[model samples]
Target: MTDDQPEEWFRNSSSTAWGFLSAGAAIAIIVIDAATGWHPETTAGGVLFALVAYAAFFRTKVGVSEGDFVLHHLYSTVRFPMAALESVSVGRTLGAYAGGRTFVSGAVGRPLREAVKGAKREHKPLSNHADFVEDRLNGLAQDARDRRGIKRDSDEQFALAEDVRRSWDWPLIGATLVVAVVFAVLLVL
Candidate 1:
């Protein structure tokens, strides 16, 4: 890393609220179970639920570094080289498409939308931070493409982006489901 190297940009919008809430809920459940003589299984299930919530919602980081788009989730990370990136699409969240992979940012953009709605309800205008992030991500993607090469056709890029968007996070989803099922079983028995 040097001054000439592009600075990394990172976003983890759910850390403050989601992280604290999940942690607090976990701790509270454990404490209450201990004091009230709840079954140990119930405590364990509550803790596991808290862990799942923290992992899925709180422990996420999305960024661009070293000419790669990075998505950091609870137990995995996916990276896509900027050279391979076709474009970025942002809606309720941010996504970078490259090499048939989509790197999605955690929870973002929603706060900006809520702020905008609040302002509108109060008859005031609101500054949108999501737009700034979208612009920055788009600029980085373009810069990456330019640095890599400019020979790619628009149709090819579009196809690749679509493929990336459609790709699913099967591992994480599966693990979460397993945890939920186990927790349910523990509660029932």
Candidate 2:
């Protein structure tokens, strides 16, 4: 693939599962409320629950493309060039830091121990998706450094321009915030 092409793009499957489960629960609540008594309060609660489900499921994407690591969320898109990356680490989740900003993968947790056990059982090495992605990103970062003739140094820091700004979806953020405030107020009153 060309430099501009994405190596891969993936959302957190676990988070997607949770989103679907929550949405299903919300629908169940609404159906139960309607069938039993059609209580307005119950209906409102169901709607709020559904909104939370939407927010969780529909808002996050992570990818590597064009020599940059990109993170997309409900309100913003953050990008960091590979050369500027200090490190990429995965624990319960994945994270990369560059230019003094940290970009976290939106996906759910991935346990390293579980992956290692599975790999051993399957007689494979580093066969899990998370490990594969981590390796690819690390390789890309190394390539970027090589291209720039940068050597690994403990004392020197790689920093990008301070003015680098993430693209934001203001309208979506505003709407979500408004809905959240309304939901909170409803609960309070």
Candidate 3:
């Protein structure tokens, strides 16, 4: 809250919850199709693959921790000094610019949330989930310009910096790998 304190906060993507729900849906569809014998093996396989690919969108995120802007991209978790950040923008999805104007998908919006919540009232927005998340991320980015060069007690800042710079979202990556192995076994069997 103060200029002297480090910025720390996070916003979760709806994709995370929806991705998990989608995985379950994909499995159920496959099982039901397997029983009905309605689709060919190739057709089922192709569809499942597409569904799984879409589920990878779950990893996206945008946050600020220890005066650093963190982005959880599909391939990596990147953290940079908030001072280097240029701006956060919203369109169909959330986006940001940092370090000489390189754009990144800082966050993503999910319409699937509407399907889970059911139809909204006549006055309510259909894309409320996406809109809410985009607004929060942009709001944080707007106020975080002062966090660029926060100094902490000796060694702590170094450790935090290293941890942020080197860390990956290992837990998600591990779970994904485990599920892939299980699915492979199921397919082979």
Candidate 4:
């Protein structure tokens, strides 16, 4: 049996673009804060945080390749045979606030789910990262079914994925832009 080692895949263009934009925005914020010279320390921290966050997001690995195709998100790193992959598809309508920062909310799988649930239990509303990761994985499985010419339970999964992708992106972008704009406006004011 051949080893199914993962090859590094290039980051998505859109993801990279967003990363730069966010980094630029963060830098801008820091600069503006510095120019005003009121709260230099706070402004510097904000800039550093944004830049670091941006680096963590797009500069980091978005997907990993194994043999035929690439698996996206951190979950792609999970130990599983290629056979375990059900499908590979881009996640659903992403919420904007999370989009420029990430594809899925957290590292994929059960640990993420537990963290999300834990946050919710603690009254900290969490993003739908795990669900999105699951959706993408299901899509991959569905694609596999299609490719193998196998009639499996992927039909519903595909349909759901379609819905998620369509509904998620715009709102996510909109929300992020809205927040960013609000911050800009506040700064201006």
Candidate whose TM-score is highest: 2
What lDDT, from 0 to 1, does candidate 3 have? 0.54
Q: Report the lDDT tens digits of candidate 2 across residue range 53-164.
A: 7766766767766766677765688776656666766556778776566677655336666645543533221766666666667677777666666664322335542324
TM-score of candidate 3 to 2 decimals: 0.50
Clashes of each: 0, 0, 0, 15
Off by over 4 Å in 1: 1-9, 12-15, 73-76, 99-106, 111-127, 151-182
Candidate 4: 10-residue stretch with minimal lDDT: 92-101
lDDT by residue (121-180, candidate 1, tens digit) is 332113544556666666776776565544444654544344222235566667667767
Predictions in order: lDDT: 0.61, 0.66, 0.54, 0.42
Evaluated at residue 108, the lDDT of candidate 1 is 48
For model 3, residues 112-157, the per-residue Cα lDDT tens digits are 4443453352223344555554465555554554353423322433
Q: Clashes in model 1: which pairs?
A: none
* Per-residue C-alpha lDDT of model 4 across residues 15-107, encoded as one tens digit per residue: 566677777887887778778875645564565557455544553433334422232332122223222343432322221111122234222
lDDT of 1 at 88: 60
- Better candidate by lDDT, 1 or 4: 1
Instruction: Please name the candidate that would achieve the greatest lDDT relative to the true structure.
Output: 2
Give the worst 10-residue stretch by lDDT in candidate 1: 118-127
Can you list the residue pairs that collide in candidate 2?
A: none
Clashing pairs in 3: none
Candidate 2: residue 118 lDDT (0-100): 46
Candidate 2 CA-lDDT value: 0.66
Cα lDDT for residue 95, model 2?
83
Query: RMSD of each candidate?
Result: 5.6, 4.4, 9.0, 15.1
